[model samples]
Target chain A: MAKQFKSLHPTKFYRDYLNHDIRPDGRLISKFRPVIINIGSIATADGSALVRIGKTTVICGIKAELCPPKSERPNEGFLICNVDLPPLCSSKFRPGPPSDLAQITTRFLADLILNSACIDLKDLCIVKEKLVWCLYADIICLDHDGCIIDACLLVLLTALKTVRLPGVEYDAAIDKKTINEDEQKSLSIYNTPVSTTYAMFEDKVITDPTAEEEEISSGLLTIVVKNKELCSIHKPGGSPLSEEKLYDCISETINHADLLITLINTAVAEQND
Target chain B: MEGKQRSNVKFVFLKCGVVSQAKGSAYFEVDNTKLIVSVYDPREIPKKTDYSSKGELFCIFKYAPFSCPNRRAHQPDADEKQHSAIVKRALESAVCRHEFPNFQVDVYILVLENDGSALSGAITAAGIALAQAGIPMYDTITAATLAIQGTTKLLDPTLEEETLCTVATHKSDTEIDYDSHGIIVLAMLSTHEQISEFYQLGNLDLETLNESVNILMNAAKDIVPLVEKCLVDYVTKTLKSNAES
Candidate 1:
């Protein structure tokens, strides 16, 4: 009943807006909602950032802990990204193991951050095969307004930038690692990757689609770009796009990536100040 | 210990209807501790039962992975379950369960940051959210936590203050014996002037316990006005929008 009602009213309403080259929220076909970010708000975590894309709010907190590196990749550290869409964020979610959307977003984000090589895991190693930093990036969505992937990616990367690890002194004799809080160093950022999500309904496209827009759109395109390089493109296969249209999406991502990078830099600078 | 008066500090910054999707929602902050609660619409109970007259109140209390000093697991742990049970108990009686028999009103709370008194904060936020959701309630419920240290009681204690309560184990150690510490969390229906639920941790004598309860009740009362204002603001906004529409 709810699905039928959604399709009947909101879907048609969205298509009507797209017919005129505008979105339901009154944005241009390639326009995005304002992005706001606050870094280092979570004091308990080593690094943290809270980001909002339109009404979607996500808080990403990174905790750095020392552990033994994997035997095969003894020199590399570990990075894990978990996206939590708790019931508090929306009525659709429940209290239990993560839903499919949560898991998929988590995996997609983990893959994006890793494949993009935003942070070199090798730099996190303290002692070869002995001690390394395990960075856990947990992103919790407070509101599920729409375009969660973009919000999650933005917050996670911003949180990563704010991460600082204290100096660790390894005692081989006892094999005990002593952390020096006075000496701290920020993680080396290899690349800054920003993602943009577009919702295509029939032949028209809406940028940074809101929750309502996403539900009715026939296809979804999420593109991750880093330093003018295409890092990743994810589509779950709803509606097929022509090669030219796909290129248009990629170019749109490139355009938005520059703005996102500047937004992140401003947020980080404001945090340091 | 820091020469700060308990009553001087205005704790528990609160705002209601923060989550747009939830039927009703609230966000609360006290010091670094922050909690967000959303009350979803009543839905049919998934499990079949043999003729139940009253509806159910489902509560889930989650601590975000980075909410505390330690990294919490992705899944809800034993402590979270315990808090959920307490919250469910505190709210079940206050809600008019007969309104929606065979259904459940889901209250989900997430602690974004935890410095201390998270359970009490959750209870308070959940109550306000439920009220804003238009659920029928006997009265608005509010909760307050007090950490008893010796003869002094600290209201709205932080995580450190909550643990400052060290129980005296030996009688011969008079200094430590006098230092008997514990925590009392009370959820009350201020209009009815009755406590819906109470949770105590550690040990306390009857006299000290009574004194602590009084302090907690007063603290809970102080938060009532703030909750009322939030609800009033929500009602006014909703009424104006309804009128315009």
Candidate 2:
């Protein structure tokens, strides 16, 4: 009987559960799924991470290259982020170029890296106006269930935290740089930010919705928190919510930030060990 | 890295149906190199410029940005495009194209790590994925690579070994850099006993090339049993699940 109703009137079915203060997946209104992380799986990459939350999985690989610095920001470096949602991951994605959702998430991730002070750009400079490290962080979705941004954000953070740059020496007289591939150095991370996605189902706002729930939901609200403080909020377009409901989402994300940080730390530490 | 294993293929790990969305998918890992091959169902040809009696096959080969020693761009480069063509040619003869006329099947290979012989790995994985997709095929396909230097033939060489065998080292006085060394990749249908594709790099005498081709054929044939075992396992698992449900 339940399965028949679920397939017939999916929205009405979800509404029935919401009225009973329950979710189809049995998660509470503010409950979040557990995160599983594996670091440095790609041996060729400077850094790599595979993160899974429920059925959604995302892998991030960071490639570091040397390039000439911009004239205006000579000491600053670059963190170019891109997201690929191939047809292998989900049927919604096509085989052509990056879709709008991918482009939007890529830009949103780049913005979070810059605004959250995750890493200082000056640390990547080898010489003033000469050479700087450009990190190409590519995030690929291997599985698409729902709430992909949260998994991608954690993957980006974990991959960046595990990056190790090689020893580099610049010669002013020769105008060339020599890199010692063996002598490795690690990056200094400033702050680690965590993200959580919540969906507005009619009047009820549920956190960490599955792909099915997201389909029935009206809109999505992503909350990014670092050190128990709000770092960024990405609410592209959604139903209007009063101040109290919005604060509820932020507070839930902030409470979960510590758990995410610990997960990342343990995963990275395992690789070192 | 020594003994009889040195001249034979390296240790490999393979899994099927890794990508849930694709009709068929396989992941192949040889030591440090890892790749994923996905095949989609036959669909209408994108442009459809002309009428044809047979179906079309499209292959795309890509190396992840962090997969190689050098940082790769997002777009496909010249080498990757060539590899894409090579892979398509390797799998062309095995498929029964007349079954799905005018439609097109797409195969995508992404190398997560390019330790060595990435092209050969892609070809082998592509064949397995195609079979898993239930595409009509005449026979099972397998591919192997051999690196030749003088009289030495190394099967499935590593990246360092491949470069050393292919790239010509500059001499102090000699003008000719072409040496008796090169790398060869061969794809063959195991049951049909026919070679589908052959790709060679560097310079080698006809005698050496002939000798290496024979060696690669045997190496490629040896892989047939393992691929069959994998496919058998897949069928057994599916049967078991279906029976339970």
Per-residue lDDT of model 2, residues B1-245, tens digit only: 21222457777787877776678888888888898888999989977888899998889888877888887887778999999999999898999999999998889888888989898889989998999999998888889999876666789888988887876544335655554678899999998799999999988888988888889999998888878887888889999999996
- Chain A TM-scores, per candidate, are 0.95, 0.96
Report per-candidate DockQ: 0.85, 0.53
Backbone clash total for model 2 is 0
Weakest lDDT window of 10 consecutive positions for candidate 2 chain B? B1-10
For residues B1-245, what per-residue lDDT tens digits would candidate 1 score against the true structure? 63443743255688998888889999999889988999999998887767789989999999889988889998778999999999999998789999988889999998888999899999999999999999999999999888776666778888888767645444455544544467888999999899999999877889988877887888889899999998998899989999996
Q: After superposition, which runs of candidate 1 have C-alpha atoms over 4 Å from their true positions?
A: A1-10, B1-9, B166-168, B174-179, B240-245
lDDT of each: 0.87, 0.87
TM-score of model number 2: 0.89
lDDT of 2 at A35: 83
- Model 2 alpha-carbon miss at residue B221, Å: 1.8
- Model 1 docking grade: high
DockQ for candidate 2, please give it: 0.53
State the local distance difference test value for candidate 1: 0.87
What is the iRMS for every candidate structure? 0.9, 1.7
Interface RMSD of candidate 1? 0.9
